[model samples]
Target: MESILATMGDQLGQMLVVLGGALAVGFAGSGSAWGIGLANEAAAGIMTEDPKKFGYALVLLALPGTQGIYGLLVAVLAMQKAGLLGGGSVALTVWQGFGICCACLPIAIAGFYSAIWQGKSSAATILMIAKRPEQIGKAVILPAMCETYAVFGLLVSILMLNGIKL
Candidate 1:
């Protein structure tokens, strides 16, 4: 039984590697997409009021998108260590492979949810700003509050990878 488990782990390691990478990419990208969506929606709304702010709004929307990039970076770093891009050549243990997969989950899950929540939050703030421009700073700060953990998650994944044998 132990031998079978080990064999399965070895075989599953590759799958986990790919899965982790995909999850990282998917999770972070989803957040970015939603953030971009919020920005676009806001831009459309703002453009109706003043077209000059379009560029500024675009930057604001894209700011939340940095989370996804961080997730992707962690995934890529893990994959690189896994030799997906020809870096990791060592044989990975079941524990190591499992750790690699687990490491990615934090940012993926956090980024995915936070971005969406932030988007809605952004929309509300933007709307509030529409009524009173003085609320813009508060609006911006609100979404940022959600983004810290996603960044931390990304950091965790990177550190987790750093400790992995891969």
Candidate 2:
């Protein structure tokens, strides 16, 4: 009975860790998709007005995509940390698994929100550049501002993952 219970506990821990990885990837990836879609809609409109603006519009459309990349990085790191990426698996305690899950939340939440807002910002910038193409430089900076939070979240998640002992 004792051994069976211990095994169950270990399995539960592993499940939690996997859940953490899923949350990191799922939330961030979905957010990026939505963000890209939002920006694409705006870019399509702008491009219709002047097909020459494609180059400038492409840059803005790609800005929100970085958050998804950041989320994937975090998820990969978490999986590697948990030994799930490799053939072997770590025997994590329930507390350790929960901690890992919590650690992933920073990037998961920040990436989701920042990407959506950044997309909105990018859409507005796309419209602005439609009129004054020369201002593309300054316009890029506006959407880039929203990226700062996503970067911070990624940083915190990395740091937290590093701090967690296997």
Candidate 3:
């Protein structure tokens, strides 16, 4: 029993290592899932309203999911930092681990809101497309505008993760 207790104490110190990596993988992926769901829902609604608008809605809904991919990149980096890749000491401090988490936060936060906005706008745009498919260009412009923020979030995450010591 004492040996087991000693092992548990040792593991306690390593918890941050697991936590930092988990944060990156879990939250980042969820952000993407949220975006996908909202966009999909909006696309479904638009498709029911106007079947011809399918292509445009599909692209718009997919755009938000790109942010999730950015999160996944950071997660992979975190695992590398934790030495799950080549088994070198990353020795990530609490502050460093926290910073990594912060790096992923923007994508998770910005992605959640922007996806909904894009989805709704896409739904509206689908109507315009149904009326005139040539107007699809203009309809896409709104979601394109929303994409700027997701891009910024991805950029920030990439920059921060680059600095993490592995």
Instruction: Give me the candidate number with maximum lDDT.
Output: 2
TM value for model 1: 0.82
What residue pairs clash in candidate 2, if any at all? none
Model 1 ranges with Cα > 4 A deviation: 1-11, 131-138
Q: Assess candidate 1 and give its lDDT.
A: 0.77
Q: Report the Cα lDDT for residue 43, model 1.
A: 66
Candidate achieving the largest TM-score = 2
- Candidate 1 per-residue lDDT over residues 1-166, each given as its tens digit: 9999878777777668778888998988888798769767976898799776665565457666877887788788877877778755657665677788888888898888877777766666666666666666786787788788787888888888888765
- Candidate 3, position 110, lDDT: 63
Model 3 regions more than 4 Å off: 1-31, 86-89
TM-score of each: 0.82, 0.94, 0.73
lDDT of each: 0.77, 0.90, 0.64
Model 2 Cα shift for residue 57 (angstroms): 0.6
Between which residue pairs do clashes occur in model 1? none
For candidate 3, the per-residue lDDT at 85 reads: 75
RMSD (Å) of each candidate, 1 decimal? 3.5, 1.6, 3.3
**C-alpha positional error of residue 131 in candidate 2 after TM-score superposition, expressed in Å:** 0.3
